[model samples]
Every structure is written in C-alpha cells, then in structure tokens.
Target: MERTEKETTYQETRRVQKGDFAAAGQISASYKNMLKRLGVDSKVVRRLAIASYEAEINLAIHTLGGSMTIIVYPDHIFLVVEDTGPGIADIALAMQEGYSTAPEEVRMLGFGAGMGLPNMKRCSDTFEITSELGSGTTIRMGFNLLN
Candidate 1:
C-alpha cells in the first residue's frame, strides 16, 4: 500500500511530566498500542515506538516538563516532542553517539549513554531538533508508514 504525503491525518496527543522515571516510555507504549489497534505495519510501529520512547526519556531525564504528540496519516506517523527545560547548548554535540550531559546518577540508572538523540534520529525517517540555551527543546520526527 502506497500513500502520498498529502494524505496526512491527525491522530493523538499525550502529555509527559518531568522526573517521571517511574513512568518512562508510558506514552510510547500507549502510542504503540494505539497504532497496533489501528492495524499499522509492525515495522513502522516498531520505529515509532523506539523514537517515541527515546524522546519521552529525554524529556523525563533531562527536561523539567514536556508533551508528546502523535499525528498519523495514510502514509506516515509524525511525532512532536516539546519540553521546558535546560535546552541543549550544542545540538551537534548532543547528536554524537556516546556524548551525554546526563548526571552521574542517571548514568548509574542505565540511561544517558548519549544515545537518545542519535537513536531517535536513527529510528525516524525524518528527524529535527531545535533548542535554546536555557529555554527548552523541541524535536520533530516523522516515520513512514508505507515502506
């Protein structure tokens, strides 16, 4: 099944709280379930799950608060993550694998390996992140449903 980019559709939106380690990935899990229920392709679902989880974790672990929105079209799934926290000073540096500013405690908890942005970019068909020094960050990711 092939779909054109013009066939985009709005799906759902979810809010994420900061310092919610206990509930990390909850939004992605629910989004995955929703996609599954909609009969979306497994591969697309997998990619969305991975990307969404990474974005969610970044918000919880790094930001003060944020939200995740899922927009589904006939051909693709779009994810927009916006947060209100200390923004990335260097997006290029942040994108490097194994480069993280996560605190020691976060690393000890098995996260902040500097893979969040890289992993998100890897899993999405299109990915973009913008941040200010002290304001916050916003990430937009798109996953193709028709491969």
Candidate 2:
C-alpha cells in the first residue's frame, strides 16, 4: 500500500552556541511562547518545553555549537537538535539514568545529572538519536498533537 505524506506547514530554526550559559534556555523559551500563541495544547507544550530545554542545555554544555529546528504539521510537532562536538561513545550507557560524563564544573552548576536524554525521550512521542565518536550528535523528537 502507498502511504500519503503530509507537508510541513510551519518551521523555525534556532542556533545554539557553545558554553552559552547566559542564553541556554532562550530557544526553548521562544518556541514555548510561539506554541502558546499558536494555541497548541498545553500538555503538548509542556512536554516540548521540557524536552527542548534538556536538548538546549545539552548543546550548551556538551557541544561546540549547533542548531535546533522546529517543524510543525497538522498532526505533530518535530524537533531536531544537531551539535558539533565529541559524540557519545556508548549511547546505551548514556541513556541510563544517573550515568553522566559531564565535567566537574558542569556538575557543580547543578545541570548534569545524566537525565537529559532520558527525559527528552520520556517527554516525546517519538525519539531518536545518532552520534559519531569524534564528529557530533543529532537528536530528533516528535510530539503528537492528536495525543
């Protein structure tokens, strides 16, 4: 059977800079505001907010820099976070709760508890991640509006 594909009706991309602690949550905040203005479901907004914030914090703390893209369709909200940095060597291990490789400084800031990826997955309707040891990592999360 052939499947039909839906076209994206809206999209936005935000750039994240390395170690930009001062601006860590800006992208997620902006998207949250936009979602609110667009009348997205509060539950969906809350899930996206949590996931987006986690992804943004990861980029700031782990990667050199990256961009996050938000795509909205009739059925779903999609988020793509890609970063240029040392990628995870063991995705399985990284996904475990309370297992973190964050440096001491980041831990001191109360940011790295090894829950980012797991939380994002938990909040998303769909989640996928790919990484290359010395290259980078990309994470994709989707929130279904129909849920």
Candidate 3:
C-alpha cells in the first residue's frame, strides 16, 4: 500500500540538526504553511502541525541528527523521519506517554516532557517507529485528508 509518484501532489524535505534550537520548529512550520497555502482542511493541518512539531522536537533533542520529509497526496499525507544515531532501545517503553530518555538539560528548556512520541501517535491515523539502539530511528506517520 505505497503511493505512486502519480498520486503525490507535493513533497518537501528538511534537515534537522541535533540540539539546533534555532531550527526547532522550522520543519513543522514550513509544512503547516504549505498546507495552508494549498487550502488543506484546518483539522488536518492542525493534526499534522501538532505531530510534526513533536517529531521535529524529538529529532532535535533526542537524536544526533535527522531529516524529515512530507509527502502530500490527494487523500493522505505522509511523514517520514530518519535520524543519525543514538537510537531508542525499547519502542514499547518509549510509546508510553510519560516515559522519556531526555536529559535534564533538554527538560530545563521547557521541552522533553516525554510527550513527543505519544503526541505523534495520537495525531496521526497511522504511526510506526523503528529504532536500533546504536544506529538510529525512523518514524512514519500517515494522516487522512478528511476534508
């Protein structure tokens, strides 16, 4: 059930640097702007914004580095994020709402409250995360364009 090129309406990719405070919300903001420009429904855009922001923060605060890409289809939107290294060991535990591996430094910044993954999952119609402890993590989230 993968989308073909002919079905994609638009796509964009952004690089995320680890601990890049200045670029923290750039990815999500860019995506949100694009959707708004495209006249996508507010509910879908809001869901995507929330999930993408959490995904962006997780990439910046948790991984060494990563890239996030968004693909827009007529009836669906897909987000694929891949990070460099220092991956998660337990996907199940990480999915827990209050569970987090973020350090005190990140928490002090008013983030890393252990809600990233859960928020992503909650906001998306489909969510999948795969991580290898020493390698990296990949998260794919899909949203339906109900509007």
Candidate 4:
C-alpha cells in the first residue's frame, strides 16, 4: 500500500551533483529534518532516510544530475528523484541483488552492490520507478509512519 498523502504539507528540494560522492548524504539529512519537523518518530524517520539516501545516490552515480524532492505530511513522507542519465535498459536485471552498472571506481569505493533499488524497495512502503533508454529516470519512494 502507498503512504497516505495530504494536499498540503512542508516541502524541500535538493540538487544532486553528478559524480559527487561527497554530497551523497545530503538528501538523507534533509529528509530527516523534514520528518522531525512534522513530528514523525525516529524509527520511521530512519527508514525514510535510508530509502531517500539510496535513491539520491543512485541518481548521482548513475545519471548526469538530478533533483530530490521531499514531501512531508501527517501520515507519511514521499520522496521523488529525477535524473538525466542513460536509462536502465534492463530494469529487471538492474534490480537484481548483485547487478550494477556503476563504474570500477564506484565498485572500488564499495558504493554500488546492485542494492540501491532493492534497498529502496525494502525501506519504502511503496516504491515506483519509471525511465527510458535515452531520456531519464524518475524514482518515487513512500514511507508510512503508521507501520
């Protein structure tokens, strides 16, 4: 099931940089702040943080650049990330546990284990992704506080 969303709430936006590993953690922090301000508990906040961060880094490492948007409501938080990169040609394969298209340097840094999509799916109550081979990719992650 998807997180229940309200028509109005606090929102935040962040710009993700291409190949900027150093800035990878910023999205998670921003999500956490949004959650806190909305009076969400720490446990649920942590789950949302993990999912949001993974999605953010996936954009940074795989795509040229993108933006992360967080929407916080009373019941849950929603994260949307859009990137301009070579779309996943085989999404099914890319979702596998050990499949990744990350470069050798990224692998050496222990970043891409083919777990970004899986982790995002695991952490969010409802996850959605859409992409095209030559266009871009967009990921939507939702975490429910009621769970």
Which candidate ranks first by TM-score, i.e. highest? 3
Q: What digit string (tens of lDDT, one per residue) describes model 1 on residues 30-142?
A: 99898999899998899889989988888899998989988888777889999987899889999999999889888888899999899999999999899997889999998
lDDT of 2 by residue, 61-115 (tens): 9899998999988788899999987888999999999988888998888899999
Clashes (backbone N, CA, C under 3 Å), per candidate, total: 0, 0, 0, 0
State each model's C-alpha RMSD to the native.
3.2, 2.5, 1.2, 2.5
**Mind giving the per-residue lDDT tens digits that candidate 4 earns over 62-116?**
9989889887766667788888877888878877898888888888877888899
The reply for model 3, stretches above 4 Å from the true place, is: none
lDDT of 3 at 53: 94
Candidate rank order under TM-score: 3, 2, 1, 4
| Reference-based lDDT, each prediction | 0.87, 0.90, 0.90, 0.82
Q: Estimate TM-scores for all models.
A: 0.91, 0.93, 0.95, 0.89
What lDDT score is found at residue 61 in candidate 4?
89
Q: Weakest 10 consecutive residues, lDDT, candidate 3?
A: 18-27
Q: Candidate 1, TM-score vs. the true structure?
A: 0.91
